[model samples]
Target chain A: MNRRDFKIISEWIKKESTVLDLGCGDSTLLNYLVASKDINGYGLEKDIEKVQESIKKDISVIQADFNVGLEQYFENNFFDYAIMTQALQENKNPDRIILEMLRVAKEGIVTFPNMGFWKNRFQLGFLGRMPISKSLPNNWFDTPNIHLCTFEDFERLCRDLKIKIIEKKVLNNSYSTNFFLKLFPNLFGEIALYRFEKTN
Target chain B: MENKFDKKSVGIVVPKTAEIKHSLSLDCGKVLEKFSLVFETYGKLNKEKSNAILICHALSGDHHAAGYHSNDDKKPGWWDSCIGPGKPFDTNKFFIVSLNNLGGCMGSTGPNTTNIETGIEYGPDFPIVTVNDWVNSQKLLADFLEIEKWACVVGGSLGGMQALQWAISYPDKIKNSIIVAAAAKLSAQNIAFNEVARQAIITDPEFHDGHYNKFGVIPKRGLSIARMLGHITYLSDDSMRQKFGRDLREGKLHFGYDVDFQVESYLRYQAQAFVDRFDANTYLLMTKALDYFDPAKDHGGELFKAFKNTESKFLVISFTSDWRFSPAKSHEIVKALLKARKNVSYAEIEANQGHDAFLMPIPHYFNVLRNFMENL
Candidate 1:
């Protein structure tokens, strides 16, 4: 009930709107949204144990691999927002999934680690190995981040996909950077959060 | 695994009641009819009794709900898991009574019984009995026993239909009702299955229009085939695969259709064994009764209206793999019950066992039943 992510998600969501949380592990965020914000939320998680936990908490979750596409569930403009926190880079086709999220929802919210942060760039340039930082925690072989990208790379891809960014924030650990993110986001930010609307 | 007992004893020894009588009479207007009630009670009935449970039997079921007879090799009747001394419907606290239905062949006045007028077996000439008739006879038995109302009435399959009828007909007679693997009305497919079985019986050469007894013959093959078909409906395909796949009877295939497959041989044995105890005419009559069952039809075609007056708590159970009376049918029942604003709990158990899952000792069924009964 008092988790930091739950608090952040609760504050971010508006009252009484349709929400779909992708990779919503155990549905704690959705449950919080349902109880506190009065938002109708459904979760999609791949792990069986997490799905069971979600069910035990009386949360509606469909256990499926979201990378295969959610065509069965959502038609165009089905949800007010599709939230993917700490899960965009883990997908097999991150860019395609992002487009699908935008296609399904009026707006898409994505959060991921900033791979072009100074520490990661320093580790890759000086050490000549994969960056193992606080945000990206896995070693080379067992890591789930296959197509990790920087904040600037996501902005370029968003431009190419004709998606307009409504708002963007960068987080250093749990604190949001107000000034530094707007100035030099690719270097100073450790995590990038963006809200975008599909234009194409 | 067979137990030795006296075949001619007429009654099995029960634990309670100083001298237990076998038959109880109910005057159905013109004739004085008797009900064949075989019950084994484990506890005492208190004054102003509030702890009585009446167990109802399904199709092809009898009154032996728990324990073994000294001579009978067959196991106790179905629902033994929930009716034992310390089980959910614990006999230690409640007085349990199970009766053989009026048209049942198992020591009941069915087609096998003799009619007083002709001094011959009733056979096919017995009057068509409805679920109401069965419940009426149970009412007589309850009156004879001096029991005012039952704490609960629990049953499965056809037994479930009777339980629903009891709740609708005599709303105040029961406090709780548990209906498992049942429907408010028999579907067209179910009716078709029964029709096929009836045709199988009457078409047999030896049937002779239910007068085969005169010729010292019985419709064994026809009845066996009917039973084989009915048995297939009672089980799921997954259960069949787990039981007997394509394994041969002996070493190799017979190359002809003489029971080469193990499942074929097993079904044949089941059919033949069933013919020994069950009467063919009774089978036809019971199947017809089940076919004609329409609780909703009686109330101007509104099922929820039929249950509008019921104040009893309900527990409706359906198995996931039972295609005969599937979970969808149970959901229909639930929808009607919900419309009536009655307190109802439902569980569609995940099991490979088909409609007969209510009779099996699956833990999921046991847990749900136990929880419901204990809460009541």
Candidate 2:
């Protein structure tokens, strides 16, 4: 929950609306939202220790397994927004999870590491080894990011799911944007943040 | 009483009886005329009176929630683990109030007390009390203390049910509700367990139709058997095995009905101790209260509907191995709160101690509770 990413997500969310954060580890973002935006926020995390930390911050958190889905916990369109920050790539069923998010919330926000960055491509194509950059900072076998993808792949997923992209931010490992990264987001952007809604 | 006290304890204190000037119209359609409530308070009531917390007790629990009655007393209160200074309840930060519920025998107006109208003890005629009656009566105690609202109402098991009732009955008066190891309503199996315990007391030859006290003979056999049965339900099979396995008491069987295993001796000893202290008529009333608690009943059998008007935030906890009020029960509460769009935190703690785990100072459980209390 760096200041830059927090600024982007905070800008996207409306003040005083209900928010549900998926896989909200420690609830740092929701804690900020509660203080700044005064939004009614909740975190859904699996780990008990993280859940306890989140609760300590006065953030409402529900301890639940991510794979089992949210059908049992919430009704459709129960929240104004469902946000998953830098955790989309770690999910086992990325497509189903996004769709479930859209079903439970009126809008969805997501961020993930882009696999098609120049450094990652160079490591894979030129050096013939798995990429180990700051954005994706783990060995291929040890990484929790099972569904790591490019900006292009994510937009394609949005298109396939009939999810209209409201806004998209292409940032580097340090969460900043430049002219070059904006011009060639698919090739140079190391991470991506997207806000989307169903097309009806 | 002014001597130095343990930092971990609420220290030696005496229970006080509050006279309720107003008559209580119970849920059973009986009016309790001019009753009194025995309670113990830990921590100071701040100038704003905003730090008050009411501790609701489960069945078999009394006003002795924390601290000892005297300096030489061997044991502290029932919830001494989490109610002292710097503990979860945090006596230093919050004004803690624990009361013996109506129909309880611990110096509270109950079956063991004499009726004002009649010159006799109420005995079996105590008028079956419910969770609703208890909450309304507790409100009288709050009025007596001149407190405007409670910071939180906390309880485990039957006490948890009262916490739920408070959120539903007096939503605005409570800022938070911490319900641990409790259910909205008793499962059919749970009612059966209570029924068996009641029968154990009722079928005793010396019970004398709930007037054993007047007959100068207590229903020791019946009440002891009831305690033995309840003690089993409070413990997990694994915990029982770890505490007392197949090891014989004397390293060999007596071969008759003379305590073959360590568990038998332990159960007998525990049951006898309980029988000596607890009243059988009060036990019957408490079980009935546990049986009758159903906040959802008035809301068309929908628990979420019952929570629709709740203004307070919630923290519901459950233990993994607690078969009496398992994690599944807590899930029902959390799900209902979610359905009602209320702010709630749910923790399904991994514990090996069964229903009794809620009473112990399990590190993870205490960690979560302390964090929640700190924020409050």
Candidate 3:
């Protein structure tokens, strides 16, 4: 839904490389990538209607839950990249699922709302309630974001897992941050996108 | 062109020229004197003698593969679709000959046919027959018709099993083999269905140890139950759901044991109508023959070895929805044929008609058969 994040992902994909988009709701990103880059892209969407929509577009998709891990359905290193956008926090085992994506693909791209944004922290501290913003809107009970994380937490986890961060970008809605994001991304940005390659 | 025969039992004046001759043969050093032999031919033969095609029938089918008797008002043969003038088989161009299997209830002799020595019907006493035995008996018929080799051997279902056997038993005697909706080995589920059908037949009180004639009664109920059970397997779950979901018959639920569901009514109608034309002993014999069929057994365990020496080109067709003899089984046949280095073409057509799809008017089935015949 974020145009800036879409542009960043679109520019990162290599020409003619195989791609798989996990939790590919409606398969919009993969469809766009396939049409423009001549990429052979597949989508994994769990919703029946979304699967039907993908089929109508003639895009190959398997309806499955990504949280269970991707080992049973695909071989190791089956794709060039596994992309997950606004979908990481919804997973039950986000860390293990990320490791599986890394195992299946040469690289993994994950984008999620920045929980430690200054506005979210200030609202939580002063109001004594969960923050609701443009990126994270739902109340705590009805929200799909069970394992929410901030940019710093994700980077530390990536470091402990020894995954090399190839590229990183922070966005305030559709606009990417300039030098402010590199200095203090959690305070200035509302969403964070990271592309990491398996180091070992 | 029409010769009439007076059948005593049914008092049915059928065609005399279509007389199917029967004989008791002593094979394996007279230890097994089973009912076996050749049947009559209808049309004339071509000059080159290479225009012959052997037509094998399915379960509960007989040598009456085509044509109707002048006196009897029954319809033409079962496979009249592909076995007539200007049809895919084109009786005009090919000389077709069908055989009653070794364990069938037709004029050739089966469980219901009287055993000469015992002066009673063979019934359950009939020795277990293999598909190989059916092919071996057809050899006699081929000889009787003066056919050195067949241009092609075509069959479907159990008939397809016989066609495969013909290819393996006398490889040199065939040029092409068409096997439809058949398998090299029966699956566990298929065997289980047959077991249930057999149980239905044997459990009836009127069966009387396969000697119901002593009580002047036939196990029609048991036979009908068996047919009902067999009929269910002949259709796919999707087809059944589409044809008869939870739809009730004529009236609302009385909560009695009467036929309530439309499927039940349909199965009952099928079972009742089937009894009029078929015999109970025949059902048992034919099913037993199917159960004993293991084409790979003769080749020491490797199925490919069975077709190793065969030179016949094969065309194996399977229907997607035919779960009774699924496409996977057809693939097994094709895989073995491929490994044997035989020329084989396979098509698993998408159809919802289930195992009965082979007998139905599916365009893809006809088109594929037509194309294959033209190329041949």
Candidate 4:
């Protein structure tokens, strides 16, 4: 099933654009983009099974760690877009990876589950326990979302890194966005998608 | 794309020999003054002569890569499962050529061949050759066939190393390369196994300093043991255990060392069959060739620099369970190709068949090959 964030992420990507999907799990995003846009791309996956899955689908994927840096695999300004979905927070250095993405591609599209949602806040404030919701579905001790951030935190980080925020799409659990949800995305939006490029 | 040829019908073909009266300069500073190469071809070479594809064989593999040698033959070529009319290396679209290397025993100039200098079998006197030497020899065969450039060079295991060497040595001569279950260089452990296999043959009582040919004696026991050891490395533990667990050869075990387990019997049969068709000195040279394969050594110890001039698009594949030539080794090649900024595709297939998985008819593996070839 295509995630709501992926659908939004696809809209920002131009047709036939070359993509490098970092932390590409099973490469469903790459496959979908290829089928719909006829785009040429490769995926970098650390999981062996997922890499095999991508290969079986006839998708080109390299089994590699994103944390190890992309300079070894990609040349500067090589790809039209470098995309990472629901995998930024899990990276060792999300800021460094974003910078590397901009160095390798003209633009980068990133999507992650927002940590500042009202439900997550209520669980921590009212229940006096670590938040656990449908979006963040892991126990506190066993979770990959190590560097989770809200929409505001990501925007602030992007500004500090001199990365131009070209576009942003705030989405609820079901993808529908109301006026109030747009106004207070950090508190209401479950997932946040952004398209950014390096500032001149 | 749909040719009306029956997909199931075996391509009944015979191998031919190309007599090259010219000397081949070996990589180890030795020259093969004259030799003949036994090779098999499938399909027609197009008008442009551009559809030629070379299939390099592994250590024990021969010139028979596809089709049945005889009409009554029960099995087709060694790689028949993937080289038929509609198979991955589709004969309908590509002219496939596979040859027995210079030091090979299968109808080629090898230890079994009579040396013109002394009018005796070369045997152990066969000069040590490298993968580079093998590629150069194949290049001569290509020149004789009037093929300017090959559409693709495809191989697995040692054969894959040959494919890589073709791209590195003759960069512009190849358009694509499919290297499966191969490595840039053998690990120390890999060399140890080859050394042990060589020792087994050399230490045999029947082996009289490689003079067995003159004495009309074959190192059967030593060769058999070497084949058995090679067989164990070819298959994964899971595969061997699955194929032959603790099952007894007989209904009950005698508790002695006389082939109690079914696995022991299976290894014996494999060894016997291999020794009957293969020569001891040829095996020694092949292993030595494998041990010395390191394309990066001459390029300032940089594999990426070695491919700086290569123009061939690569499709590198490895099986997950192939610990002998593990995914890690395959990744080293891929990393170098990526660093070189060459067009490359890699796949690690899910398989438990180990190193021999490259020869199997796994759907995913065949699909990857077909996809890459179609795209090429």
Candidate 5:
């Protein structure tokens, strides 16, 4: 099945443009971009096996830790776009990464699991336990989602980083957005997709 | 004869020598007037002649890359595991070309061969060849074979440099280039190792200033030392520890450097085997070529600029424990390829086999190669 998120991300990319996919696990999205958008895509993945898998797909992928910045490898505005999907919270420095992405590419696309989703709020408000739901599946003690945030929190951070959000889409856990979910994105949306560019 | 080798093997192959009618000018400002290239081919070339791959050899590699020469042969070719019916490079699907480069000591022309004018061994007279010269010679070979475009050009270490040069020099001649455990140029430290190896050979009294063949005396001690040093660089500390682990060969210390350690014994055996077959002059020439390889030198010193004209896709692989030509070097190539907007794939395999990992049949390494070839 085509990942709805990948379909959406592929749609936003310009044809035949250069791209860098951050934390490109298995490089399925980059692969999709090459096939769909005819883009020259590169990926930076931490896991070696995933890097190998990406090679098998005939995709150019560098095995490198995302926590370690990428400025040294890429020059300013080297790529047409930089894209990261569902990997904002479990990072040592998400803000630094966003700025680095902007430094390397003309534009960027980011996605993360939304913390203000109604189900997450129910776990925190009603049961009085740490938020746990479909998107945030791990127990609070062992969860990798360390810096989970709501919609407003992300917007404020983006504003602080001088990254202007060009477009924003909020989707449910099934990767779909509905009329009601769009009406109350912060409380109802489980996933967040944002396209941004440098203010300058 | 009954089939005695493994089913997947190409089996009972023979090498053929092709006289290069075209004179090739060397990068060292000399012309190769006459030379022969010894080559071996496996698998059938399709009618379209599209499914053909070229395998370039490293410093000591020859055209004998796969299969057995005789029914009684003990071991198969160097890359037998990778050049068979169902292996990576898969002979069942693609025709594979392996050649002894122009300035090689194998059946091809090199220091071991007689000069056309002097009627004696070329020895030190074998003009110092470079990676560029090798690629140009390979182009002639491709022309001789009538292969319009190679499906892929593959190599490891110095061989990998040749692959990169192949892509850069004759971009339209290859569809893909697989470079494993190599860099665009030798680092200062890498050049130092080669210098040391060169010094060892020249210091031998029997070396006779690179004409040991004149006196029928091989520089056994000197060449052995050089080969031993190369052996050390090709393996990692982890692999060495796992293999020898300070294990005493004689179960006790000999105290007099009489091969007490198992690692020492292993190195000696390899050195002796190498010294017997390898020509010291050819070794010297090969080291010089490796030291001189810098594809970016002419392109405004920008590696990416060198690859700007390349149309072939690239797959650059490196081993984790290969300190000799580490993953960092491969990354440099990948970065340049990215800057050039070329289709490139980089895979740094988690291997303890060091630079020698490319020759090994590591399941993961082989899997990536197999998949890349299959997809192509």
Candidate 6:
């Protein structure tokens, strides 16, 4: 949604790490990471125009679908970090794809819009309709986010899957967290960014 | 978007012949004591003889890849769309060379050329030449031109296969390779189509086992049938539907096997025109080479291993509707290049022209080509 998530992801990534950016639309984050961290990596995108843009930026990108999985194309543990920015909910199976990412990389970083935010709750509970807040802008019928998840729901999934959450960042609409967000992130936080590793 | 390199700028260019007296060894272990090659060159080679780019021609394609052969000729070379001054190939920046393959019907030594020893047309007796053979012959031309290494070797379809072979055969001799709409090997279905075309040519009574040249007769019917079949594979269903569809040629169906459908009339015209210029034996050899191409076979059944020793960077392009050499086929090559850790860029353009889309002036396709050539 903003450069905040990209900056946080870049901070988590180490210099010279081999990274793979999933659904790297136009490769804005990947390009930033390359310039800041000097990382060697590739961006996997599905749109032809986005892939071409990445090429123009001198980023190595492969035009592919994230739903089909990356098992056949990339080697195991070849990447140091697999980053997905605001695209986890759009995945057909987030759990399976995250596991797939862990298989190819040692660590995985993902960001998603928090459906349990206060505004969304107020819209769905008081208005008696699907929320259409700043974070969830699309209408209920046309939204690309198939699996809307809250901060707690994501943490619960990590615990269930035994994935180690190395770090977590919760942000509001302006991409900065306040005391209210720290106290009740599931209610106040509009976006959640996580850095995790597979225990297995 | 000015079309600076238009038809009028096609300017005077002619094919030149080079006779190599050295005995060349083929991949099939055959030997040709001597041979001749027909080629055309545009742009000047620098003093260091370095800025050379070789354009390989596909099946039925000859040395005339760009520019007019004579002032009166109405049509330029087949790939004039992308080759010229300030174009993707950019004659201003590089020396462009295109040659008729060894087994082609063009001025090069092919089925129509006279055998050195027999003093008769080689016809069907011409030894089978593989992609490797073509690359070897091109090297002779490179040597004669004083180019120690080509800046790039580019081709589409069968020509693309030769480009791949060039990188594999002499990794140090080619700096870059542009392979479009080509595969490492043909599929079973692909081989089946070629087999049908070959059958059409050989079964004709006039063929007489490819000695029609000596009998002062041409297997026009058989060649026409083969060309007609090849034309179908070169185009996609959507392309054919858009171009001809079920429209009647005379506004009413004859219903008697006469050219009723407009598509039938189009195919008939294409076949007849092809028969007038091409030889049947060359068609047979071209298909045979396509079937025999399998660079991965000798490399432990792994396409990646085939590129392990390749030193040249590659730019691979494929079209969406090119069922003859689908995007999946192009992916096979791209994936192998990646596995081998070679520098590669791939693009699958949206197109409805099928295999022939590589020859068309698709804006995005040309943009990628131009960018790649400029960067190289």
iRMSD for every model: 8.8, 0.6, 12.7, 3.9, 1.8, 2.0
- C-alpha lDDT of all candidate models, in order: 0.76, 0.92, 0.76, 0.88, 0.89, 0.88
At residue B133, give the lDDT of candidate 6: 93
Model 2, A53-111: lDDT tens per residue? 99999999998876563867888999999999988899888999999999999999998
- What's the distance in Å from true for residue B107, model 4? 1.1
Instruction: List each candidate's DockQ score.
Output: 0.05, 0.80, 0.02, 0.30, 0.60, 0.35
The DockQ-derived docking category for candidate 2 is high
Q: How does model 3 fare in lDDT?
A: 0.76
Runs in model 2 deviating more than 4 A are B2-5
CAPRI tier for the interface of model 1: incorrect
Candidate 5 Cα errors over 4 Å, as ranges: none
Q: Give the DockQ of candidate 1.
A: 0.05
Docking class of 5: medium
Ranking by TM-score: 5, 2, 6, 4, 1, 3
TM-score of chain B of each: 0.90, 0.99, 0.89, 0.97, 0.98, 0.97
Error of 4 at B310 (Å): 1.1
**For model 4, how does the per-residue alpha-carbon lDDT over B1-376 read when each residue is reduced to its tens digit?**
2323346544577789999877899887888888999999998899999899999999999999887776667767899888867888888888999999989999889989988899988888989889999999999999989899999999999999999999999999999988999999999999999999999999999999988987889999999989999989999999999999899888897978799899999999999999888999999999999999999999988999999999998889999899889988998899898778776777778899999999999977887787677765
Per-residue alpha-carbon lDDT of model 1 for B1-376, expressed as tens digits? Answer: 3424322112233522211233433222234344354445534576878888888887777777765655544655455666765677776667778877777877666777777668898877776677767777777667767888888888898889888888987899889898899988889999999899989999999999988887799999889989999999999999999999888889697788798888999999999889997889888977877887788887899888999999787877888899999977787787677556565655667789898787887766676666556655
- Give the top-scoring candidate (lDDT): 2
Candidate 3 regions with alpha-carbon error over 4 angstroms: A1-200, B1-44, B71-74
**After best superposition, candidate 4 residue B39: deviation in angstroms?**
0.7
Per-residue lDDT of B274-344 in model 2, one digit per residue for the tens? 98889999999999999998888888999999999999999999999999888888889999999999989
Kindly state the number of residue pairs that clash in model 2: 0
Can you give the lDDT of residue A114 in candidate 1? 91
Residue-pair clashes per candidate, as listed?
Answer: 2, 0, 1, 0, 0, 0
Q: After superposition, how far is residue A98 of candidate 3 from its true place, in Å?
A: 30
Ranking by DockQ: 2, 5, 6, 4, 1, 3
| Candidate 6 chain B weakest ten by summed lDDT | B1-10
What are the candidates' C-alpha RMSDs?
9.1, 1.7, 12.7, 4.9, 1.6, 3.1
The residue-by-residue lDDT of candidate 3 on B219-285, one tens digit each, is 8888999999888888999999999998999758868899888998999999989887777777876
User: Between candidates 1 and 2, which one is better according to TM-score?
Assistant: 2
